[model samples]
Target: MIRLVAGYATAALTMLVLDGVWLTVATPRLYKPRIGELLADKPSLPPAVVFYFLYVAAIVVLAIQPALREGGWRRLLTHAVVFGLVAYATYDLTNQATLKTWSTTITLVDMAWGTLVTTAAASAGYAVMRWIGK
Candidate 1:
């Protein structure tokens, strides 16, 4: 139980730190230049918080725990990448399909970012859980 909590916390923290940097640096350079009109003046905090919570939970459950049980780095990374790609693809493709403002470049870039970040976060979570269990 404690390990579960620790895994979630570690993954969430890792994700927050990584995504903070990306958003700070990339938003102005990548997103703003391409989709400035679509962005809000400031993000809506409530939904952002909810998204982090849910995403971290999914990572812990779907990637971290299974890898820990199976005892293989391959399993962990594969799961994390797959989950990230699928989740991000759903959002990116949906926007691309429906929104006139959405672009293929943004969709591809965001999906790549999501995959990298999710794998990093899941790896952090898996490491922390192993340490705690020992």
Candidate 2:
């Protein structure tokens, strides 16, 4: 139980940090609103940061063990990548359409970053699992 909570929390924080980096350096010019803004606006939600974090963790939880248990790095990585992209793309497309901020360029950029970040976050969590288990 503790491990489960930690997994989600760790993922959320990871996403938040990555998001900060992206906002500060990746895409700062076009007024691209970030996770911070989203979360701040709604106290109920665990911030958009948590959304991404939970996303990363969820993917790893569902896909990682099965992949690692059954195959090799290729399988694990592939599962992570597919799940990450789907989550990222879904979030971006839904928000873009609703907010009327649709843009192919942005969509691709977000998807790319989301994929990379989600993979990184999940991998990081996996790396620290031993410590977390205790």
Candidate 3:
């Protein structure tokens, strides 16, 4: 129970930090020129809220916890990278296929960002759980 809670907390927090940096710092630099027009002029509150809540939970439960049980950081990171790739790929590919205005550049960049965020979060979660257990 402790491990589970710790892992979840760490993963969620790490994800939040990574996302905050990406959205606030990186977005203007990396994304604005590429997809500025597609972005909402004002932030959309509901979907952002929903996505973070669900995404962190899913990463903690599905990737971080499993990796903690099965092995060490390598396993956790592998799981995170694969999970991130698959999850983000689904979204990006779907958007590319259906959304007439979606940019391939954005899809590629987002996929990379998703992978990075999950990898960092999962690693942090696994490390935190190990430390707490010790």
Candidate that would win on lDDT: 1
lDDT of 1 by residue, 1-134 (tens): 88899989999999999999999999999889888999999999999999999999999989998898886689999999999999999999999999888879989999999999999999999998989884
Provide the RMSD of all predictions against the true structure, rounded to 1 decimal: 1.0, 4.7, 1.9
Off by over 4 Å in 1: none
Per-candidate Cα lDDT values, in order, are: 0.94, 0.64, 0.83
Evaluation by lDDT, superior candidate among 2 and 3: 3
What are the runs in model 2 whose C-alpha is more than 4 Å off?
A: 1-13, 30-45, 49-53, 96-99, 130-134
Give candidate 1's TM-score. 0.96
Query: How should the candidates be ordered by TM-score, best one leading?
Result: 1, 3, 2
What TM-score does candidate 2 reach? Answer: 0.65
Better of 1 and 3 by lDDT: 1
Give candidate 3 misplaced runs (Cα > 4 Å): none
> Which residue pairs collide, candidate 2?
none
lDDT of 3 by residue, 2-68 (tens): 8777877888888888888888986788668876777788888899888877887888877877776
TM-score of each: 0.96, 0.65, 0.87
Q: Between candidates 1 and 3, name the one with more favorable TM-score.
A: 1
Collision pairs in model 1: none
lDDT at 95, model 3: 83
Candidates in descending lDDT order: 1, 3, 2
